[model samples]
Target: MKLKRCFDLVAGLIGLCLLAPLMLLIACWVKFDSPGPALFVQQRVGRHGVPFAIFKFRTMAHDGTAGNVPRMWPAPCITRAGHWLRRTKLDELPQLANVVLGQMSLVGPRPELARYVACYPPAVREKVLSVAPGITDWGSIKYRDEGSLLAAAADPERTYIEDILPVKLAFYQRYVDQRSFWMDLRIIASTVSTLWR
Candidate 1:
């Protein structure tokens, strides 16, 4: 995976450089819109079930546990600017730093909170945790409207645990079984197209 790591380093550095202005702008907007730090940090399950602080631009109000639950306001805790950032996935830009730091890959299973990871069956957990978690993966593209989907659920957490998470886990298992450098490139390309279109 030397080449994969190199690609991550190079692409992450380039992406960070290119997105600097936008990141800064978003940071400032988050600060102005809310009463908390612009960046949100949370413990996520990484490779081998190791926990790490994943970074993202804060898209909610200063409430400490706004994102801890499955469903919040459709636009509840979000600020005016936060809405745009979340919609465009710009809030995820800081994860390039995570990639550069080797905590994540460009394409792999999206890291989950420790609470959710605790629910993963041992074998499936090991399979998904065998690789570094990613910022984007097949599950991500397929569930790009996850917030909206959750908003429509009678019980968001239940629906996620029973329905959504299982499907995502299947995708993660498949990705782990079939991953390659070329596959990563294709996933990234597909993500870009999905985001832009």
Candidate 2:
């Protein structure tokens, strides 16, 4: 656990350093492309069910309705730049700050919104939240295109809550049960490969 935290701290700092210039460019692009701030911050359930502000590069229009999980298929609120940002997953880059702050890990179960956490089965919630939520995990890898999947569903929110959430929870549990430094590395490598491919 100590080693993992140290690794997360070091990796997060290094990532921020290496990615800062690109993040600035993306932030400028987001600002020029849309009317809102470059970063989006939302509360997510973290370790031990604590709520923390998770940051991401803003990928939606300036409308007040930008924060929640996608409720609409073909989400009409996405901005022109948002389309590409979300597609490339560049929208998640700001979360390195969260990782640096000790609020998140580089790899683990992805955090969920409070509403979604409330729906987690008690044992599952306990097991999953036993560790810090991560920037990427098996669930994230598998559902990388979750918004697109929901876009194709008849009732996107319902499908997310009923179908996708359960699968994600199972993945989260598995991650917690089998967690290790090596596992985290594998997950990170997989995420990079997945993104590149």
Highest lDDT against the true fold, candidate: 2
Task: Write model 1 residue lDDT over 105-135, tens digit each, in one string.
Answer: 9999999988888888999999999999999
Q: lDDT, candidate 2, residue 36?
A: 84
Per-candidate local distance difference test: 0.87, 0.88
**Hey, what RMSD does candidate 1 come out at?**
1.6
Once fitted onto the true fold, the runs of candidate 2 whose alpha carbons sit more than 4 angstroms away are: 69-74
Q: In lDDT terms, how accurate is model 2?
A: 0.88
Residue 103's lDDT within candidate 1 is 98
Tens digits of per-residue lDDT for model 2, 14-82: 999999999999999989987889888888999999999999887767667557654234478787888
In Å, residue 73's CA in model 2 sits off its true spot by 6.0
* Candidate number achieving the greatest TM-score relative to the actual structure: 2
